[model samples]
Target: MVSDLAAAIWMYTVGPWLDHSSKFTRTGTLGGHHLLLLIIALTGFLMLAALAVLTDNFTHSTPMLAIARNVACVISVIALTGLLALILMALLSRLLFGPLRP
Candidate 1:
């Protein structure tokens, strides 16, 4: 938890710095919909994976912990599924439409 907190703090402090840096925008391949889909897919995968790990970790513990984790797991899975579905739809649209030009 402390590590997560530290990482969060670091990102909060450094994210804007990275964003404002001249190298940030030009660092990656600039695509219109392709870049957006990549970001969405990345977030969707990460969220689902994190929630799965948390759910697994919380299992086989105290009764309260089990109950809370179960509830949270269900909610998280539902939300993640919805988000991933949207990301999937976006990807499909981009694939069908071909890459957009700036």
Candidate 2:
């Protein structure tokens, strides 16, 4: 629930800010934004990996643990999907609008 909320907040807030900022900036390249998305994806992957390791280490599983695992997986997928959409949007924008110029 918390993760979902956080993702929603990020998408609604930071995502638009990036979009707006990209428009004003003269940088022709979106390398920095791409790098940011990559970093976000990496962080999500690391979190999911850590959860998996923790789940494996535990012999007995509880109901809460199962719920937590499911939530974590869902959040990770959401994050990746959002990032993919952003990347695709960026690529399409570049193709349609051409590169930003000074």
Backbone clash pairs for candidate 2 read none
- Residue pairs in clash, model 1: none
What is the Å distance of residue 61 in model 1 from its true position? Answer: 0.8
Supply the TM-score for candidate 2. Answer: 0.37
Tell me the whole-model lDDT of each prediction, alpha carbons only.
Answer: 0.43, 0.54
Model 2 Cα shift for residue 93 (angstroms): 5.4
* C-alpha TM-scores of all predictions: 0.36, 0.37
Per-residue lDDT tens digits for candidate 1, residues 1-102, read: 232233334334443443455442222212213233334334444544555476684444567656654554454343334334545766887999988885
Candidate 2 accuracy as lDDT? 0.54
* Predicted candidate 2 versus true structure: per-residue lDDT over 1-102, tens digit per residue: 344345545544565465456553212113325345444545555665666677684455678777766666665665556545556777888999998895
- How many angstroms is residue 49 displaced in model 2 relative to the true structure, after the best TM-score fit? 3.4
Residue-level error in angstroms, candidate 2, position 22? 1.7
Model 2: weakest 10-residue lDDT segment is 23-32
